[model samples]
Target chain A: MRNLYLFFRKHYFIFLFLLLEVVSLIFFFRHNKFQNAVMYDWTSAISGRVNNTYNSIAEYLYLRRTNFILGEENAKLHARMPQAIYLADTQIYIRNDTIMQSEYRFINAKVISNTTNRRNNYMMINKGIMHGIEPHMGIIAGDKIVGQVVSVSRHFSWIMSVLHKEVKISAKFLKNNQLVSVEWHGGDYQIGVVKEIPKHLIVSAGDSIITSGNSEIFPEGILVGTIKQVKEHQDENFNTATICFLTDFNGLGYIEVVLDMFKEEKTNLKASFQEL
Target chain B: MTNLVSRNIVRFFFLILFQVLILNHINLGGYTNPYIYVYFILLLPFATPRWLLLILAFIMGLSIDLFSNTPGLNAAATVLMAFFRPFVIRAVSNIPEEELGIQPSMRILGFKWFLSYATILVLIHNFALFYLEIFRFAEFFQTLLRVILSAVFTLGLILLSELMFYGRSKK
Candidate 1:
């Protein structure tokens, strides 16, 4: 027993080092899978407050640019307003219709903190559980896809940006309706790669890629990027294309969290079907 | 001794804030991220107990990870760097017994000694960090490029900060 104590005393530092390293590695591997919500809430709450304070001070530096973008978006929205549209068929009376109901609700949130340099980048928004933001919901800037919410605190949420390697967005070519997956491969924040394109398809530069609405997260027709180049993959079957993201991730200021109204119902229906 | 402890405490928070708030935003070319926060680990007093050193390094790293939303990458790298720090110091310089408790700095140690020490530790930290971040050998060359570039930038910032302190102390 004394010999064992001496051994421990002599090699305690090594044991401690090993212990810490193992703990950290566990945290690393278990981060995305089965995230400890309480720990995340505690940490994010503190970081959220700090980032919120810092963002409030730094917001002034980009006011002009933000205003310009907002103005452009406002003009586009204004053009689509009923007041701006000329009615050619005045005989047909326009009435409130019960057939169509709102499918997606948009909640405006300011980005508190964002990073693009890392392989797995994340963005923090100034809205969370209290503000109706939840995990697995989509986020967008204007009509461009930004990311999906991964975790939420009381008043803050973390987003796994499209720049993340594991984030594969279901997208389709706007011209042909051909489906493809958009993924970031850990370099160049402004660019992503489109995969699963059959080699026979005629793909060209500048082809627009938009959300396919195959998943519950994003609605259809939201812009993702424009194709920059297409390269033949090692497999003889599919070709991959590089795309330029429309949303400038580095200068993201305001974003909207997409709350699909029927998401729960759809998921529940799918679950019931799978049970059979 | 109390004064030294308090100063280090102040430096610990100051470095974390400076790193997360300012340095993180400077994503030059989307490749070179200067992790000057590792300087805090480098500047700890030489006589700090091995267990305490490891704990402090872990806490510092975890704090940075929390802010950045990277759960464990920084913590692992910083702890490893801290574990290697004593051996690195012994290899780089022959310190007299009386100078055992002094902090490592360019002003106390010559610029050459400080540079090599900082370079090795920063490289080790960045090497572990960037590789573990990508978690693959597929992009080995690209990740290596990022590691070297980031390490150079981090070393430059550490030396500059040390020089700034050196100039103030001289006055």
Candidate 2:
């Protein structure tokens, strides 16, 4: 007994270090999808409260710049209004032309806290479960696609920004409607990559990329970004295109989360295929 | 004592806020996010109990990781870094009898030695972090590239912080 006591006294710090490390490892290894759901659900409340306070301060600092961006976006929309009317006038003459169509809905909320430099960047918004925000809901800022809601509390939610590697959205060429998966390469916040565009399909610089609406998270035809560069892979059949994101995630302060009514049915159907 | 506690609390909150808001947002082009919050861990008063130091490091990392939602990644990195810190300090600094009781800082260890010690320890911390995050060897080269690039950026941020916090005075 005496020897055991002395031994513990001498190596108390070592024992403590080992203990904590063991606890951390256990936590890491034991975590599964179910545990993740519970953990995020618990932390979501704490984060909502903490982020609410931090976001208010951040909101104050970005007011001028946000207003400026909003003004510019508003002007661009107004400029397009005249052309939209011209097209509508042209469409009135032709009853069955479905080529010209537009589908978009914008929900505005202040960005409380946003991190772009991290390997997994996340943005918090003031809207939450209480405000119709839910997990997997698509998010947008102004005219550009940002990310999707990962978790939500009563009054706040977290966005898995496009800057993160975990973000993969179905995107396609606006002209040909060929679907490709857009994912960030963890290099630049402003640039992401669109994969699996077959080489035979014609691709060019400055092609517009839009959401494919395959996932019910986002409505089809949401503007993602424009393809800045297209590189033909040496051996692969697919060409990779670099996308220049329209929204500056670094300066983000406001965002809108899009909630589709059919998300549950669509997600369930998609998930059922994977389970088999 | 309460005054000191309150002052530290304010500083702690401000540091974390700045870390997540401003520093975490500065991408610098690639897989590099300057972990300035480790400065909080580095600046803890010398002679702080080993257990207390580890707990503080864990909490600091947990707070950031929770916000970032990378599971236990940051907490694991910070705890490992804290565990190794005292050993690193002892290995690098041959403390004189008079300076034996002092904790490490620019004043106690001098700039060159302090920086060397800090760089080595932070590199270890970041390497462990990158490896764990990848947690796979399939894309070894890509992960290695991320580690090197992130280390350089983190080193620059650490230097900038040292300059800002301690200025030119050796003490």
**What does candidate 2's lDDT look like per residue over A18-77, in tens digits?**
776676666554433323265667776676677777767767777898789889888888
- Predicted candidate 1 versus true structure: per-residue lDDT over A1-276, tens digit per residue: 999999999999999999999999999988886343788888988999999999999999999999999999999999988778798786544554665677899999999999989989999999889988879999999999999999888889999999887899999999989999999887788889999998888999999999999889999999999999999877568899899999899999999999999998999999999999
**Model 1 clashes, total count:** 0
> What is candidate 1's local distance difference test score?
0.90
lDDT of 1 by residue, B1-171 (tens): 797799899999999999999999998667558898999999998789999999999999999999998888899999999999988988988867476447887776788888999999999999999999999898899889899889988988888889888864321
Q: What is candidate 1's TM-score against the reference? A: 0.96
Report the Cα lDDT for candidate 2: 0.73
Docking class of 2: acceptable
Give the best candidate by lDDT: 1
Model 1, DockQ value? Answer: 0.80
| Candidate 2 B-chain TM-score | 0.85
lDDT of every predicted structure (CA atoms):
0.90, 0.73
Model 2, which residues run further than 4 Å from truth? Answer: A1-15, A22-50, A72-106, A267-276, B1-14, B25-33, B96-98, B134-171
Docking class of 1: high
At residue B115, give the lDDT of candidate 1: 90
